[model samples]
Target: MTKGKIKVSSDNIFPIIKKFLYSDHEIFLRELVSNAIDASKKLQSLETMGKFKGEIGDLTIVVELDKDAKTLTIKDRGVGMDEQEVERYINDIALSGAEEFVSKYKDKADTANLIGHFGLGFYSSFMVADNVEIVTKSHKKSAKAVKWTCDGSPNYTLVDNDRKERGTDIILHISDESKEFLEEFRIRELLVKYCKFLPVKIQFGTNEETVKDKDGNPVKDKDDKEKKITTPNIINNTSPAWKKQPSKLKDEDYKSFYRELYPMNFEEPLFQIHLNVDFPFNLTGILYFPKLKNKIEVQKDKIQLYANQVFVTDSVEGIVPEFLTLLHGVLDSPDIPLNISRSYLQSDARVKQISGHIT
Candidate 1:
């Protein structure tokens, strides 16, 4: 067992993060899930590069909530970490493991899809949790499983864990002030908002589904009602329409995605523009033009901006021209720079190029 203080520049870092790190405390869910996605992508990249020889089992990320225990856990079968890696990445503030991994495997792997850019994202757990625990075991065959725990303070403890899986589990002990997150509905809402279009599958819980017969028809009971079975409630679409190539998608595909984006809006989209560019900056998305009403009331800020498919903001004033804000859909770019919270965009020349291209 080992115990030490986190290597932060200031002792008040936890308080700062809990209070004002992000304008909205709900952003902690996005940050933590994004980190889990990054880990899964990294493991896939390694497999592609012939570095990892193990079987890549189910990589689905699961968000589990225990209301009675006052705990919420984000579990991922991704690239886990050993003790040294945890000390360097989690203990050290602002040192991003994703950034380092990208730099190391830039030429060998599909690193652009990685979502984490700031190391401080993990600490966002403190925003809502009084204590956090990370149980991880590295992909390396010889690595031992370890557990690291922190209590919203600089002090932390690292001890051996009995976890046998090659992945990570982040267990957050919900604080009294932030007990709203422990609710199943609240967590589901956040997952839908931020992770609806993520590349990896996210399972919240299980939902009853009508069992299907061998002929692809719903199985019916003796009462003539459909037979129901429980299945994993996957909240996000692993591959959204925007992520696909224009050549592969039909007109209905665009309209279908629009419906998925705006479920409440009954009207269909008029047309769509598939924006795929890799020259000046990496950007891909689908922008939909909805049928206008006779009232001519312009609705702005329908466009959502994403950094590596992690929803950053819908208010994309600087990334896209004001005129395009009336259009609905998504714009994803790894080139766009973001602040620590990833709640706002930072000024950059690439952003201007993206905006100009949209124009």
Candidate 2:
């Protein structure tokens, strides 16, 4: 193994990233998984353009929790990086491989599918992990696997690994303060909240799904009527309603998606509006008008904001008019800028144009 210091502008960078950079440490999960999704999408684009002459096998992102070991692993079947690429991308701290990939293939429609335009999302893992290890093997033929290890400091170790997969596995040593992330239930909730609509499939550890009868009731065995068969649960919706063409969706379809978005709300939406625009900016979503029990029933955070299908935040007041916040729905656009917290949506010229269109 070779040891080197992570190139950074300041020595206090890790502290800042762990404490002040993000509003909540839980954001680390979204950022890291989003990075994995972006990498997977890049490989898919390459395959589509005939650049990668390899099988595009299962691209499901897996989140594995080892409570006894106090470790959490996020694995992806994506475009893994070689040692040199890892040194340049992870160690350099300022360069975004996604940005360069987009610049290189800007003409292709799939290039816009990436979510980590800002280079710093990967470092968010440091907020929750005392140490992080990356095991990766690039997709190029004859490429050898490499492992990169770093504590929450400037020091990092890089060495050859025997991993025989064309992807990456991020193993995080969960910190005591961030032990909540080590729970399978907590991790699953985070995935459902932030990544249900992601283009790539995401699977948390196996869950049992009770088998139902033909009449939509629990199935029973001959000996015991209450007994039912259960199967493994797959957590995410690979293709959500918003990603589908509006013409192809019916009212029931939109309503079904609304339930998927806000499962707790038992009431059906009063009306719905599907927004799809592509000229000045890329935006697509479904806004629901829920029946209000009272004038104050209108909530501020009912609307969720997403960028390239990864949930950013529900607090989008700066990007949209105040009255618009009264409506409950989802808004997805690849053009908007997101800050560190990924909570406060950044307002810019393009975002203003988008807000105006929504208004």
Candidate 3:
């Protein structure tokens, strides 16, 4: 049994995170899931670079809610860490494994979809959980599996584990006050809001799907109704319309994506503008012009902002022009500067340029 204190300059870090790090406690899910997606992307990058000889199978991230145990687990089949790596990354505060991996393979791999920036994402789990356990097995051949446990304090425990998978499983023991996260509806809502357009697949639970026959037709029961089968409920569209080439997409494709973005809004858009710029700062998104009503304020704040496909905020006042706020759809850019919480944007010249480009 290896036990040690987490390296931090301040003893009040955990408390600060729980109380003030994020304005909304629900952001804990986004941060943790984003870390999981980063792990998966890291593995894909390694495979692209020929560094990982093993098969990269099933990169879907699964978010399981164990309400009986008051626990939520985010599992990913990605680049898991060894014992020493866990000690350095988990024990040491503010050292981002994703950032380090991207830096090391920036020239050798496709790391455009990696979403982790701040190293404090893992600590956000403490905001909603009383205790957290990370069971991980490295992707390296013959690597040993290990488990690290922390109880929302500076102290932590690391021990050998029997985990057979080559990935990470983050188990969060939901706190008494934050038991709402254990609810299926709340988790599904959060997954839709924040991770609906993430680059990797995210499964929250299972949904009923109509079983199909060999001829690609729905299988019917004796009563003539379609026979249903349970399948993993993947929340996000891994490849959203905006992520694809505009030339390859038609008018209907854009409209379909708009419906995906706003299922409640039934009105079709007047027109769509596909924005893809790469020179000053990387940006790709689609802006929709909806029919304006008497009140423009109601239409304002419909433009959603995303950083590397992770939804940041819908209030894109500074990033987009005031008039453009009436527009609907998404704006994703890895170059956009964001605060530690990723809830707000930091002022930058690129931001001003993006606003002007939108105008």
Across residues 1-359, which tens digit of lDDT does each residue of candidate 3 receive? Answer: 99999865557776887789888889999999999999999888888888899989999999999999999999999999999999988888788888888898888888777888778888889888999999999999989999999998888899999999899999999999998999999999999999998989999889899889889999999999999989999998989998899999999999999999888999999999999999788999999989988876655568889999999998888888775677898899998888899998899898898888878
Weakest lDDT window of 10 consecutive positions for candidate 2: 225-234
Off by over 4 Å in 1: 1-9, 215-226
lDDT of 3 at 320: 80
Write one digit per residue (lDDT tens) for candidate 1, span 62-150: 99999999999999999999999999999888899999999999998889888887788998899999999999999999999999999
Query: Which residue runs does candidate 3 get wrong by more than 4 Å?
Result: 1-10, 212-226, 294-298
Winner on TM-score between 2 and 3 is 3
- Give the worst 10-residue stretch by lDDT in candidate 3: 6-15
Full-model lDDT for every candidate: 0.91, 0.86, 0.90
lDDT of 2: 0.86
* Residue 108 C-alpha lDDT in model 3: 88
Candidate 2 Cα errors over 4 Å, as ranges: 1-10, 209-232, 294-296
lDDT, residue 84, model 3: 91
